[model samples]
Target: MVTSEWTGPFDPSSDPEELTHLLSVLSSFLSYRRHAHYNGTHVRRQAFYSLPSSHWSLLSRPPFSVLDHLSHLDDLIDQHAELAEAIFRVGFAFLAPKLDSEWIGEVLGGDARVVVGDELKVYEKIMDRLGVKASKNDVDKARSCIHQFYREWSAEGAVERQKCFDPVIRALEEEFASRARCSPNLNLDRSEMSVLAPGAGLGRLVFDICRAGFTVEGNEISYHELMASSLVLNHTKTAGQYTIAPFALNGSNHLTREDQFRTYQVPDIHPATELASHTLNSRVPAEERMSMATGDFCVLYSQEDSKETFDAVTTVFFIDTAPNMIRYIEAVRNCLKPGGLWINLGPLLWHHAAKPPPSEEDKNKDKEDRTTDANERDIGIADPGSVELTNEEVVALVQHLGFAMEKHETGTFETGYISDPSSMLQSTYRPSFWIARKK
Candidate 1:
């Protein structure tokens, strides 16, 4: 099981917490996110590992939910580890800006040395630093990232991300080559292309791009994610080296695969190893090729020399998180070079879409406050679905903004909340993607 201390970022737009206890709670959350000693054994709840799904339909049709494999406690560890890591990273992104490298290394890098009122101490320190209070609702709203952890930032879900960009990468190469043909002086192979992936969660796509031999910068606004990612990247020298993070599922009993009835440790995660193969190819190792910056996507490059020079600007499941999707689109367009690629893959769930207008027929009836207490109403929170556009509508907007649509696709991608092959918490999104060039 993962320690809930780390793995969430701060986003106050949706009212996660009130102002009063926010910093204290944040400190408490960060304290727990760090690893601690339990009964003299070191537990690494920070590192995320994927758990295998255990389904019983292995003997049945193509959509077998059961695993035909054997068992180990590793399966349970993986799913839980993944969730733990996500939460931990969220805190990492939050704390990164407040603490410098050495201080962070000291806090997040230690064993469970002192456990006395650690949360309180952390909270007081945070309150002192922030000079403000953090309410529970605002904190709760920020906590929503947990529900999205697996979908946007897990290895199992990575293939879906690949689907979004592989086509664009191919197009980029073709476009560059075509341009070179027009001007003999233009050298296609002389320089590496640069890409900017804003709000890059956990940097998996950033790594994938580096492996493909591009210079990439992954930008994040959250200190939690930035710190967590930095920690993961710094500690993981070899692929699968940090194997302590394990996983298991909740309902393995339903699986028909006799062996899967027991928990099984999934395969190893080789993030660092993936970079190893590409390291030798260039003077800059693959790991070095992938850079990260902590700041807002809109203003981070607004005054810098970095804008208008990137060969590509890629966003995956990112724009939907924006307070205003238009701002993100405008930012993307401004930063990319002329003829550069703007590759976007995500749903149109607009974070700032107002609730649907009340109908005249229902005007007389006062709508109930859905967040009423448990005694007054059912103990369920309202879904914060965004007011997003249809894929078609979004593409039209891009075209109007001077982008030439080169490719588009609509398909379904399933993302698992837990790695349990048998659990039913996973979800599928019917989303659209576009690969357009600035005309």
Candidate 2:
């Protein structure tokens, strides 16, 4: 169950570095309105300034029609700006009230005064309280996270979710169906089946599994995703209550201005309403049916107590994020019971494949660099410990680690990750989809 205000999954005050990072993340959401407007208007207007004064006269005419194009672009940018503002408001609504004066003072340093005159009063107030600035990269990541909402919660994302999630859901149902056939009188209880989804970003897959009549837990490492997912899963009261312009910031490859400025209502269905029915036939309490865990997947689940803890494990576009793919396979193997299914759908797009080796200096960094080092490891950035493997080798390693391949399909389904359908440039992945059972 969700509280009136989410304090977050862990106590930020426990670790000074982590507390600072959390405050930065919260500040990013508050700062996003200014960043979005600046990027949309000021930065883009510079393009027009680049052309010569006389050249504008010729370009503004019929064939080129620079003036008309500029007008249309301005409208699109405005539309996007509005959407960015909405995202910021939603983020603030979930996070801001949790801040107390003591927590705010830590981030404020000495002077508590923040330069005034932000458009949104609430936005300015939080900015003043935190008195910390989000890095450019962190703010950019916060913007990218908005696009993820369209992929995971909006109706526009349903097709992509169907392609990526359907097979895994089916595999779980089929596994239990087979068991049910053997015992006609005592059919397998799906309520007893517990599934784990590591790297469960935004939690749509985990919610889908719960809707499919099984108890499931989603484990996430990214704070951005956790914040976004928590808002949708816990605070949301109805379908289409929240609206966001996903394509507002992304301007290139747009077939039309309308396409670039497209908006969508999030959580096509109410999360709680859809899953509330799952409790009627189950022994688990309504709250226990669905849960989210925050932390590193390997560290949290790759222990002796976690061994054989879940009836199934599901990974969607997840495994390749590992520095060593073997550790991911080992973790999955460790968590599942004997004969438990490990359903996976993803390409081996190794996140750290292109990263060069770390410098000798980095290998022997001082104590002050510990915070930076720990942050790098949290995001799965390539380190001296990182390794990359081929698709064939990954399947082989899963088998070697006590899992038997029951189904394997390569290049069968072409999937898109947070893709804008109307955009001219489409990046699609023909992911490796498979189901393997623990021996």
Report the number of the highest-TM-score candidate: 2
Query: Model 1 off-target regions past 4 Å?
Result: 1-155, 176-191, 241-273, 279-284, 302-306, 355-387, 412-421
lDDT of 1 by residue, 142-203 (tens): 33333233433455445555566565566556665776688777545412678888877655
Q: Each candidate's TM vs. the true structure? A: 0.59, 0.83
lDDT of each: 0.52, 0.74
Write model 2 residue lDDT over 259-346, tens digit each, in one string: 8667788779987777676565465554666788877787667667678989999999999898888778878888898889899999
TM-score of decoy 2: 0.83
Off by over 4 Å in 2: 1-12, 54-131, 277-286, 358-362, 365-383
Best lDDT among the predictions, by candidate number: 2
The window of 10 residues in a row where model 2 has the poorest summed lDDT is 1-10
